[model samples]
Target: SLRQDHEVVGVRAGLEEETLGGGGSSQFYDLNVYLNELLCIARLLDQPFQQHFRLLSSSLSSPALVLPGPPKSLARCRAKAQVDYRGMRYPSSAHLLDVVRTTWVVQDEESLLEALELLLASQIPLSSPPSSPLRSSSSPTPSSPSGHTVVRVKNGFRRRGGYRDVKINVVFSSPSGFRVIG
Candidate 1:
């Protein structure tokens, strides 16, 4: 069995290695779960993950597109936008949180907001503290937050169509320098 299998498990694991933190999808690492904890820490809190984004969109409703567990990197060649320091074609933030994760956090749910504020308090600007109260679902913010910038977004869930929930966008700047949220 050993000689027959050319690709050993150990070698494969090395390619998809990730810190104790969530895989670098930046959903949780990117909020991939980073929001649940590390709100009290002082210094920049960040986790390293390696994953290739496959058509990063506002909502990944298509059950067809399954998330690559263990975090995998794409080996395709693509142009990196350098004008305003745009890293890769794929965005690293504001994918919106899946309801399943929050167990459908709805009205009278301020815990999520409070938790987010605490997580991003250090990097928050005096004017805005990343506390985006749940707004009228009728009107969702058109665009979401950018990776480099952590401006609070007015939209979190879709009010119409397949989307129906809305919440504040969370931003966490890691020690190595990267923003991830839910």
Candidate 2:
């Protein structure tokens, strides 16, 4: 089993709510939403990459995230889409993974703030009209005018007690079709 062997098939993203009762807030994203957003970003990064993935399994009830190196401990995580990122099977998939790894990191409060700032800087609300200069129908962000699907910022100023977590969705989409993994 993945948990027993501690096999890291994919990236481990920790999403925690700092506030004692902020997990349920609408401002923050639930696990489902977070994964879906990620899936969409993957699609946006490279259309070919999106078609290469398939829904393997979702350990939502017990999503295991094994930390590498000393003091290896599990973190709160979710994996909805699994891709064939091994070697030449899907060349661009590795790049997508690298982009995800580069953007998603949560070691401490400072790191979390930095990531949040990145998201805030990189993303604009999807609700923005097409005419909005900051966003167009096709472009994801100005920094990524070429091809870079990054975190999308949503409204809501969380309370001080809220958890320090990034919301993600669990979704999978292949050439066959799109399915909500969870």
Candidate 3:
């Protein structure tokens, strides 16, 4: 039905134009006019198919956007006690510490680092008695007279990679709770 309708219109237009005696300069001009009309019809016929093909190809190449489910290991770990911090629940103290450390590194703010240091210095019990059987009970954890905790630092040098490849997480907390000035 569509094919017949198009053909009828084209034939009627051609007949009307021929009867109107529109002046044409040469054979080349007539040929060019014919080609232009043919091209217009071809484009009209092709548009729907082109759109359909584009949609089909895009769907085939990529998955539909959908919310992801919780990670399997995280789901299992969630069965244990969770710590609430910064409006989020973490599976454990270690997880919370890791997240805090990562946030500190990502933000790269001097104030945040200082705040973290203060929080760690105040919260963590640095002078607790040694739990090792070899060490005496009277010996307290190492600290400076100014109340700064003494930390042992060991540097591991790698030949191939730069600092960008390395990730560091530092956790500091006192027995009471974690605090930041600003």
Candidate 4:
């Protein structure tokens, strides 16, 4: 009976290995696929056998590691602009500063949100935003007579590991200020 049990365990391991090792990029990509396969294998064994195999499988699998990419250049540009326009200047300089300030603030806030999302999703710490471009629709026009402009910003986070991380769809109805709908 002991010899029979060992043979069964060996056979089960072989089958699991074959299923897991089939041609693919990585097992982490489709967790559901492996999980379904695991469930089928579990059903073939008794309670005690199932527990043993579960431990073996758990030991064999590792959590996926996602490496963060280099810090974004936009943040640096924003900082430099802020420093360069720190002092009061001619009327035209002030106007230019106002434009730059508004644009920079919006971009900075967006970057903050993206960073937060990445930290939550990947369990990786990123000191700066990813290099991916921010998506913004054409300047909003008055959809209603209320003098409000409806703008849409669609942004997504893509990891350096070739996995598309998150898609953020935000809509803002303004003139009274920005309100995010997502």
The estimated TM-scores of all candidates read 0.24, 0.23, 0.19, 0.14
TM-score of 1: 0.24
Q: Give the TM-score of candidate 2.
A: 0.23
Largest lDDT belongs to which candidate? Answer: 2
Window of ten residues with lowest summed lDDT in model 4: 95-104
What RMSD does each model have against the real structure?
19.7, 19.2, 36.7, 28.9
Q: Name the lDDT of candidate 3.
A: 0.26
After superposition, the stretches of candidate 1 with alpha carbons farther than 4 Å from their true spots are 1-108, 124-149, 152-154, 157-173, 176-182
User: What do the candidate models score in CA lDDT, each in turn?
Assistant: 0.25, 0.28, 0.26, 0.25
lDDT of 4 by residue, 106-180 (tens): 134455465434323332121221111112244333221111111223344444545333332212122221111
Stretches of candidate 4 exceeding 4 Å from the true structure: 1-25, 28-30, 47-182
Per-residue C-alpha lDDT of model 1 across residues 1-182, encoded as one tens digit per residue: 11100121000111121443345453223222222222211112222211112222212332123232221111110111122213422222112221111112323336445434433442432222222112233422312222222334455444656845443433432223223342
Order by lDDT, highest first: 2, 3, 1, 4
Is 2 or 4 the stronger prediction by lDDT? 2
* Alpha-carbon shift of residue 180 in model 1 (angstroms): 8.0
Worst 10 residues of 3 by lDDT: 173-182
State residue 84's C-alpha deviation in candidate 2, in Å.
25
